[model samples]
Target: MSTKYKFHEPTAIYFISFAVVGWIDVFTRTVYRDLLLESLSYCRKEKGLNLHAWIIMSNHVHLIISSKEGYLLPNIMRDLKKYSSYRILKEIRENTMESRKEWMLYLFSKAGQQNSNNKNFQFWRQDNHPIELDPHLNMFEERIDYLHNNPVEAGLVANAADYLYSSAIDYEGGKGLIDIDVLI
Candidate 1:
């Protein structure tokens, strides 16, 4: 009944999705998307996050991640989401170029008011829907393919590898926008 994704296995790799409140197309703006990228980079470098794959869509993000030694997945996810929400919301509020600023702020503010956890804004919805990739199942490739092909399925790109915000290029042996530990 709870809308929270809890990672049970500390060492296991997880495929997690984070969505925005009201499914807002906040990532349609380049500034916001770049901020999310910076947040991920920070988590990877300073927080000991091991990112296997990642993609930032218009309203949601998919990440295949794990934590290194001395870290926990839940804790890492918590920090990543919390930090990203504040920074993204602030950027949206301050960005004059954002044409939908008022509408976006209203939606985020309303969602925040409806939730007991948030004080002012709610950028990301609470649930991450983290799925631990079981070693026996070996669905790693399947999930990575699904993540990379999301933009293609939505008709945003002709090929999965062409998506700039994803790790698909890395899987194809090219460097991506962000450094990721390629699983496939």
Candidate 2:
């Protein structure tokens, strides 16, 4: 409801970050992460999502993105989160090998019940802090540094480019998991 964090300029590239409810480490498994990757791929191909940079951590995701022609960033993000949540929840529900299945589901269900907007489960938290970047300010390099260095800062990888779930590889002149309109 706050305009402060809302996506205002549809054509402006924005830095957005969203977290899993309760900061749950849902992306620890390959399946859950892959589900999100697939959704991002679909958004890029069909929803006109022009991804500049992105990184998916254990509990949250950060993206620098804009939209092509008629698409809106907020709408694309909404669809991405909604579809990915459904896919992730289904996989969690059906995965007999998931050790944290019951606990994760309980948390998601509780979060859903607490929020009036959700009917069943709330995998992703509602607010996506979107900051429209000002090109004149030259913020892309700083933001991209922060985004790419996340895995290294978290001690997940020795080098930022070593992290497979990020666009840092692309910035380092290598192909990443998904296509991106590299800014650097």
> Candidate 1: lDDT of 142?
88
The local lDDT score (0 to 100) that residue 18 gets in candidate 1 is 85
Which regions in candidate 1 have their CA more than 4 angstroms from the true location? 1-4
For this target, which candidate reaches the highest TM-score against the unseen true structure? Answer: 2
* Counted clashes in each candidate structure: 0, 0
> In candidate 1, residue 73 scores what lDDT?
81
lDDT of 1 by residue, 103-139 (tens): 9999999999999999988889889899989867778
**lDDT by residue for model 2 (70-172), tens:** 9998899999999999999999999999999999999999999999999999999999999988888889998999999999999999999999999999999
What lDDT does candidate 1 reach at residue 65?
95
What lDDT score belongs to each candidate, Candidate 1 first? 0.90, 0.95
List clashing residue pairs in candidate 2.
none
Model 1: pairs clashing at backbone N, Cα or C within 3 Å: none
